[model samples]
Target chain A: MNRTWALYKKEVRSYFVSPLFYVVAAVFLSLCGFFFYSDLNFFLQFGFGMDIIGNFFQLLFADMSRAMLITVPLLTMRLFAEERKLGTIELLFTYPLREREVYAGKFCAAATVFLVMLGATLLYPIHLYTVQPYAFTVVAAGYCGLLLLGLMFIGVGLFVSSLTDSQVVAGVGSVGLLFLLWSASWNEASGSDRVMGVVKAFSTFEHFSNFSKGLIDSTDVLYFVFVVVFFTNLTLRSLESRRWRGRR
Target chain B: MIEVRNLRKQFGSTVAVNDVSFRVQTGEIIGLLGPNGSGKTTIMRILTGFFPPTAGTAWVGGLSVEADSIAVRRLIGYLPESVVLYPDIPVARYLRFCGEVKDLTGNKLRERIEAVIEAVGLGEVRHREIGKLSKGYRQRVGLAQALIAEPALLILDEPTVGLDPSQVIEIRNLIRNLRGQSTILLSTHILHEVSLACDRVIIIHRGDIIAEDTAEGLNRRVQGVFQTLVRVDGPLPEVVGALRSLPGVDEVIEDAVPSDAATRLRIVSREGEPVRKAIARAIVDRGWSLIEVSPIQLTLEDLFVRLVRQQPSGH
Candidate 1:
């Protein structure tokens, strides 16, 4: 377990040093910060001493989660893809660690980096608090929702990364899937019964809307948990399949 | 320290390792000799639990590799072919990560890293990123990572691959110095490496194990004849007759045509059974003078060539 922790630290360190993390984090945060600043002018009309947490989260969380849907893949893409490309996957699998342990290490690493990236945006909320104190409970719930969504996205990205040696393929492929899932929840896009079925099973944006409003529905929680578990299990299988498949 | 029985590995339709079997005793240095695509790497992978054998079993430190893959991995240090490494990581950091996975921590891990760096002569480039290092230094990094655990079994696939002659010698001496502390099974196409470093050899060719024995033993088996060239100043037929009648003589091969007053005869004696003393005495006993007699010894290269060139059973 300590080695697993060590492996997790190593993976996180690898990400911290990689340009991909900085590029994604900087781009995502600056874009979000610009939008958040623009929204702040309009939000101040609600007046002082009012608990604007409800309205504050409703306006910002949707775009933040959508932004994360695209950028999380960039952070997770190199987790296993680069290892496979360099043939260091052989070194990893042949270690005393189990397949699931390796999977957990990578997943936790991407989650840690994602958490840190998301944590930087806490400045926007803190800026709102300095002006006038607001109800902290809804803001906390909204953050929990973003964390859940971010973790699920990381899991999906990690799974996609496991299937390819090309980081480009992994990043593009996971981004494509997550964006498709987010778009499927649109009102007019679900016109077809087939699209409705997809929306029912995998629509991440629809489940996240309730969390942005600070209502932690069990169904929404379960959906995020299910997606995380499903993709993580798939990644574990992908790791095991290497031993069955020929060559590195 | 290592035992493989009837191991077979197939990459789809192509069989890479076909029912191969060999063992490495504790403190023994064994060479897995073969050319490219000869299943040497496959066997090492299977032994290291990198992948399961399509069919067969292997034991490392008395634990089944398939059944106790994790435990087996803990007992061994493996250097894969090409020694694929993360280019971005510095040498010390890479070894520290390797040491960590084996449950080493704190001062113990630091000291082990220092020890392996010293052992593999990687102290100079320990702080450099692996990608920036040259081939020989990269090799030392690889070797250092493998040696970090001081494992009971060290499975190396082409340990000296792509290194210059001097680097090869340095890597070899590094391995040679760990003789009694760890058992090693290294694969190499270089024949002299086997002769100089390995106590025993298991030769594989085309996915099949062709021969397994000590270097000298394989040499004797392949030769099966200890040849000695004899030059005598007497009748050719008479000399041949006398030499053929000597003890342990397999047959008499005429080396070349008779020159002037002397004739050359190559005496084929049973392998590893010396007939030189008898041949010398017999030549001098008679009035015929003994001009020359020298035994031709076969090298590991010759044995390797002979073994691979020969056909496999039921092939």
Candidate 2:
């Protein structure tokens, strides 16, 4: 645990010192700000009555999810890829660090950066609350769902990063993978009833929709949990394969 | 202390390290000398617990490297051939991170970082980013990180490969300062470094231990029959015949056939014994003015070439 924390601190320091992190943060915040203002405009123009705040929060969640699908890869593309490219992975492997600790430390560092970017979006909720009274339950659940979704994206990004040494490849691969997952719900339109149900159930978009509507289901939570664990373990195995494959 | 028994590593069909085995006592410094692609780095990687050998076992500090890797890693400090480091981190911060990874904390970590920074002369650039430092400083930082943990065994692979002449001397001096403190196993193809820094050298050719001895021992091993050059101001045939008939002289050849005012003859000895004195006496008795008579020094390069030729296939 202590070693993991040490690696975590080093990783976070590397991110803050790097100019790329600031670029990523600036771009993500600008996109969030643009989405928030548009969402506010839509809410003011069309939401005259009938739970305007809940609908407004739902729109913001949808925008945030879309923004994260593109930006989370930026945050995670360098996790393992840069280490290997810079020849520093040998340093990590020879150190007294378990493969899991290195993975967890890098994962938490990227997630922390992701959450900080998410934290910037918190001001949007405060703006909504100040305008008038809003449902705390809907907003809180919506943020919870966003956090879960972001965690899943981070896991996927980290796994893709482990697959290659070039950050370009990692970023592009993660984007392609996330797009495929997001588009899986389209399969529901062409399948039989039973097959459609399964497709919708497996689609991350379908699962995230429930959380956006203030509906908390264990199954929805389980879906994000499953995605996070599946990719996290895959990243771990990818690292362990370095030893098994006997390269570097 | 370290031990290996018949260690072998194969990358697919290519055998990297084959049937290689040697030991380092508690405080001995052993140099691993080999040409490029001769498996010096591969053996160091295996010893450092980065990967297990394909067919054998290695032990470091009395523990099996394959079985107790974490424990083995704790016992050894490694500086890879290329000096792998985080280029963006400041020198002190990088050392602190390595210290913490090595389980150092609080006062101990701080103390070691300060000592190593000063030890490697990195105090000037302790706050500088490693990438910005010159190659010499970067190499020093690599050494400092390896030393920060104060492990019992230190493994340095080509510690001075890319440095200029003076930087090489400084790095060699720093390594010399570390001589008695830890058991050191350094690998280099530069024969001068091995002769200057290492007490004993293990020469590997194509993944096999070709020769293991001290500098003088290696020279003697390759110089079983000696060659001496004698320059005399006399007739070429008289000088060659006089030198050949001398006791201990195996054969004498006219190196230069009556050029200018002198003739040069190369005399070969029958055994490892000295034949120079006998040749000089014969020249003097023959009334020739001998200009020079010196035994040729057998260098490490000569020994390496001979060994490589003698054992064509190291496997």
Candidate 3:
């Protein structure tokens, strides 16, 4: 059997058997559903018969993006941190598997759960589509971007969770780090072009906004890919640090 | 199947295992006997390829532990010192996961889980969550996971640490049952565990191997000055005096209770001297009753203590 897939199955089983994942998913969907209802009411009041993916779902997308964004880390805090706290990380690493297999198995499993939560929100777009026709390409692109965003968040979560054994600390630490990445564009300076270019490059919002504009720029897609790989590789390194750290 | 050469590990400035060297042959149950924090676990961790040693090398089944760690792990099944398992996971589920990671699949995986469950005596609580189990059962679960795959080498760290007397015997018997199937290296501070379960004992203290030999060999090593126990159904002073006058007997002390009919005395004799026959003859000739005559074998507890304490300070 593929060790990575076996580990992935084990982790996914653990996630679903415990109510923690179910509770988090329920809370996330309820919050997203609430926002979707209110925003649809407001959209129907103003625009009666027109619905386009970009223009119609833009405002609600922004609202739910934050919710979906926050859900990723909350789901991942226990991936490595709780294992360490339970001392299962020692058991895990001692298995006949590579560190990358463990890291990839865990990262992909968390991404799968995040994908399920993001998939459950498809009802909102279905409701909007009921009113009028819209550009499905834009919705597809938007989901693509959302997945990339979730994967990037999961990567950060794995990295943060690997850094500490406390679930609380991993949760808070990843949130703090994600906040910095999200807010990079918020304080965009009008001082100099060089400064503005640097902030735009680091800002997750800048690249994510292109998906809402129905634009799948290769550069933007590559940006999310790079960030995901960077943090996931960092997580792999963290798992491998026992070679130098001596103990897990 | 296991070899460690000058293995050293340092957590910060404190040395956990220092220049320890040993070998375990195929089909041998070697006991790494050491007290807490004496590098017993450190050596097992190295052999299991959990972490690299600071300044040494180890090989499992002829594979270099550092260079071929994943391969080394593939050949070894390890039970850590702390049996920290998933509390939310059921015993069978946990064993299944362990089996899966060990690359067991399909019906083979199922069979192995069942086999380990039966071997560790976990059938009664296979469906119970690990956290709900008693400590003894949890230890059994830990053992089950380690035994799920039946790898070539099994390394257990304190396999019977906190079990009740019966559970301890059960786990010991489980390990004993795996005698020829797997080369086992189990670490424990329990002297009786070493005596009963292991064929050879390696006494470790302060990150070094203080003694390594068979149990009987260790007893003989400590028998330079031998001792025997003799019970006589006769006068206490006369029995003690008669044994004291025998040649090759260094000293005799009464070890009998005042209420007992038979008087027991300890005869201290130099090693390699057959004083028991002479003492028996003298007792029989004096018209005294020689109820029992036996050599006092050195207990493992005493042997472990002597080996651990014989070292100089600051070594």
Candidate 4:
């Protein structure tokens, strides 16, 4: 556990030191601010009797959810790919820590960065609160759902990064993969419901929808956790396979 | 201590390392000398627990590389052939990170990082970003990373590959200074580097260890068939016949030049023979002035070439 934290600290520090973290954070915050202003203007023009905080959050959640499918890949593309390219992967493997510890350390660090980005978007709610004191519970729940969804996508990006040594390839490949998972339920034919049911079950956005609607379902939370764990396990296995394949 | 038995690694149908085995006692510097693609890095990777052998097993510090890889990894520090670091990071911060990965923290981590930085001569550029440093400094940083943990075993694969002449000398001196404190297994194709730093040399070719002995031992083995060049003022035919009849003389080949004021005769002798003295005596007995009698010495390059050429016989 000490080794895990050591790795986590180093990884988090590395993210901050590199330009990727700052660039991604700046882009994400700007997009969130733009979406929040646009949503507010739409609510004022429509004179929708519904709560503006809830409506703005719903819009923020949807836009950020899609934005995450893009930004998560950028965040995770260099996690393993840059390590391999820079020959630090071999150095890391020589440490006494287990593969699981390394995986968890990096996973938590990237998730933390994602959470921080999401946290910055809280300004939209604070602004809404100035106009009308909204239900803080709904805002909190929506943020939780967004975080969980982002965590799942980050896992997918990390797994993709482990598959290749080129950061560009990892980044593009992760975006393509996340896009597929995000839109898995696009086909809505009568016979496609059966397929959509399974797809929706695996869709990261589907699991997040319940949370955005101010509902906390244990099953939905479990789905996100299981997906994160499942992909992280796959990343570990991929690293282990390199050992047997004698490519290290 | 390190022990490897019948280690083999195969990538698909091609064998990268085949039935390779060797051992290193504590405080001994061993060199794994091989040509390109001769499994030097593969063996190092397996020994360091970065990877496992497809067949056979290896133990480092009494821990199995396959079963107790984490424990084995703790005992070894590895420097890959191409040392690539995070260029954006400051040198000191990078070393601290390495210390952390090796399970050192708090005061211990700080002390170790400072010690390694000083040991590798990175004090001047400790705060500089790695990318801005020169090649020599970058190589020093790589060395510092390996030595920060101060493991029982250190594996360096072509550590001096891309360095300039002076940089190579500095790195070599650093490695030489690490002789007794840490057991080292360095791989290189530069024969002189092995002769300068390693106590025992293992020469591998085509995924097999063809020669394993001390530098002197390898030279002695290759020098078995001694050749002496004698320049004398005498009859070439008579000198050749007399040298051939000697007990240790295997075959004497007469040069193209006829016997004159300065005639050169080449004499080949069996192993463990001092043919120079016998040739001198024969020339003196015949009342001919022997101008020069020199026994040819086989250098490490000659030995490496002979060993590599002989690899086809599967020795």
Candidate 5:
């Protein structure tokens, strides 16, 4: 197969082989299940007079996004950091493959595993589907938003992982950066209108809101794409800088 | 094939490699000999396209390392010092992974993997986790990983550093078997390893290419630091003065093992000067029975120390 695909397979298999993957996935799934149950329970309790279905999804996805913002770093912390700490990045960099291929392969691999983790939460919706009819279009839109948001988070996480050989540092740095990106607009009211607008536009939380409401904005889609591409490019350059730093 | 032109690498103020240049013909095994911190690893890194030189250029397989690094990397199979493998990955699977990264696939990848596995004598442990293997086995696996891609140039930095004596011989034999297949540039301070395995030795001291010659040629070059043990049947002071007065002779040190009849003198010659003929003649002229006059054959170890001592401090 393709070389990038080979790396992707190795990365994916690596996750399954390590206990860290199972622990992280199990904890993430348990949290999601608890949130899904709470959302469903609230819908069942206070549903006689309100848009319970919409409320259920709004809470579910928002919680999923926040949980995933935290979870992405845990999964991605080992991508480049572990390879570097183990000195296997030397092997990877010595290969004929371009730097971008390595970054893309790793990003795609982590995204794939993230998708698998996200896929587990689909059981909740599947259960909901069997009980009461929900708008398929709306669910698709929410998923598109969730996938894009997760991709951006993965890109950022991977980039952070490239900066250090310590996985803990990558993990903590990614969480802090993701939190900043997610809440950049939180204090915008005190700023000038133009500054507030810029902050809101930059905030991932702001961009993701429309998607959770089943609205597909091309601007939001482009924003996520931009984040992924930008961070992946940075990761490519990060690998190049390693040469200057005499890491090999 | 490799050619480096006036390469220089500076890490901040400390110059790691200084104005070093060399060429290697295809299929020649060149041993890069250097003391620790002698910049051998840095040079290998530059050649392998792991990093660009702070100045100068290198071409591997006719591809410029700076402009065509990916292509240069394609032609090189590099085993860095202390080969690090993924602890969790099995040897066979890891090799296959590396092969695939080199764009090998299908039947060719499988065949090459099999070949390198047997070549490195890692067939038995191919299915074991790399972390669990012995150092020698891990080293073999490292070699197999580099060999799997079948590149035109193989750059191995201290491939046998931590192995036992028998393992060292095994790895040396493995490298020997690879001759004529790929141009191999291996770096090590292990002198005997160069003498046994390399066609030529490039001695780098203080980030400089102090000497480059065949193993025998290097021995001869160090032979310039002339030291010979002479046993003469004569008055000790007379023999010492006559040997010291001889042309090209620098000093005459008497052996501490006091001899009753024969005077054992260690004659050291001036640099780049051979004093054997003069010392032999002087002893004959003095009517002393020249029992023995043999130029000390400097082992690579002594040669390394002698060369190192001749150079000023690196810093």
Candidate 6:
């Protein structure tokens, strides 16, 4: 565990020192800011009687969730791919570390970056708080939902990164996979409720929606947790498989 | 403290490391000499517990590589052929991270980072970003990381592959200075390097141990006969005939050119024969000035070629 954390800290410090992290953070924050302003203007023009904070929560969850599908890949693409390309994987394997330590360290580092980016989006809510002193529970729940959704995206990104030694391939492949999962619910509408139900069960967004509406369903929480654990386990197995292949 | 028995590794039908075996004792520097694709890196990987051998067992620091890899890893430090580092990281930070992975922390970790930096001559660049440093400095950083843990065994594969001549000498001197502190298993095809840095040399050819012994011992094993080159200011036939009639002289070959004031003759003799003195006496007997008489010793390159040729073709 100590070794794992040491690797985690090194990875995180590396991200901060490189330009890649800043580039991704800049692009993500700009997208979130644009959505916040556009959603606010649209609601004001429509003059809806619904709560403004509630409307912003909807926009934040929906658009930022899609934004994550784009940026999460950028964040996790270098996790294992860069190490393999630079031949540093051999050095890491030579250390007194298990495959689990490396996987957990990189996973936590990427997830922490995602969490920090999500935290930056809290300014939109603070703006709402200034306008109206409303209950904070729903907003908190919505942020929690975004966090869980981001974790799942990170997991998928890490798994994709492990499949190849090219960061471009890992990033593009992760985006494609996340897009397919996002659009999965549309496949079940044409007289296939049973198939649609299974698809929805696997769709990460479906589980996320319940929390965005201020509902923390146990099933939804378990679903996100399961996805995170499942993908991390797959990443670990992929690393172990490489040892059998013996190329390194 | 390392032992291997019948180690074999294959990817599909392509064998990378065949049935190979050797031993390394404590405080000994062993060089794994081989040409490209001779399974040098594959064997080192197995020793470092990076991969399990397909059909054999390797023990390092009294721990089996297959059974107690974690313990084995704790006992060994490996430097791969290419040095790869986090380009964005500072030198000190990177060394600290290596120390941490080696299970050092707090004051011990800090001390190791400082000591390794000084040991590798990286004190000037300790705070510099690794990406901006030159290749030589980067290699120093890699060496520092390997030594930060101070393990009992050090496995370096081509540590000076891409360095300039002076840089190579610098790294060689560093390894020489580390002779008594740790056991080293270095792999390289640079024959002169083995002669200079290693105490014992193991030559592997086509995935098998072709020769293993001290540098002089291996040279003597393949050096069954000796050849002497003599230059004399006398008639070529007289010099050649006189040397040939000597007791230990096996054969004598004289060059046709006598135009340069000195005639050249090569005399072959059985091993352990002192043919130089005999050639000098022959030249003096003929009242000719002997310009030079020297035994032509087989260099490491010649020894390597002879060893490889002695191996069966299927190997």
- Stretches of candidate 4 above 4 Å error? B225-297, B312-315
Report the lDDT tens digits of candidate 5 across residue range B1-315. 999999999887888999999999999999999889999999998988888999998999889998999889888899999987899989999999989888899999999999999888887888999999999999999899899888899999999999999998899999999988899999998887898898989999878988889865666676655678899888888888888787777788988564345788888775423578778888898788999988664688988887777776763
Against the true structure, candidate 6 reaches a TM-score of 0.89
Residue B213 miss distance in model 5 (angstroms): 1.5
TM-score of the first chain alone, every candidate: 0.91, 0.95, 0.94, 0.95, 0.96, 0.95
Could you give candidate 2's per-residue lDDT for residues A71-164 as a string of tens digits?
8898999898988898888878888888888888998998898888889889878877887877788888888999998999999999999989
Q: What is the C-alpha RMSD of each candidate to the true structure, in Å?
A: 4.6, 4.3, 2.8, 4.8, 5.2, 3.8
The backbone clash count of each candidate, in order, is 0, 0, 0, 0, 0, 0
i-RMS, every candidate?
1.2, 1.2, 1.2, 1.5, 1.1, 0.9
TM-scores for all candidates: the values are 0.87, 0.88, 0.92, 0.87, 0.87, 0.89
Error of 2 at A165 (Å): 0.9
- lDDT tens digits, residue span A130-163, model 1: 8667776787788889999999889889999999
Instruction: Report candidate 2's interface RMSD in Å.
Output: 1.2
Each candidate's lDDT (Cα)? 0.85, 0.87, 0.86, 0.85, 0.87, 0.87
A1-248: candidate 3 lDDT, tens digit per residue = 38888889888988999898998899889988988888777777886576555445776777777886677788999999998898988888889988888988998899889889999998878776786668778887888888888889999989999999999899889988998898777865654779878888978999988886677999999999999989988888888887777768
The candidate scoring highest on TM-score is 3
Across residues B91-122, which tens digit of lDDT does each residue of candidate 2 receive? 99999999998999999999999999999999
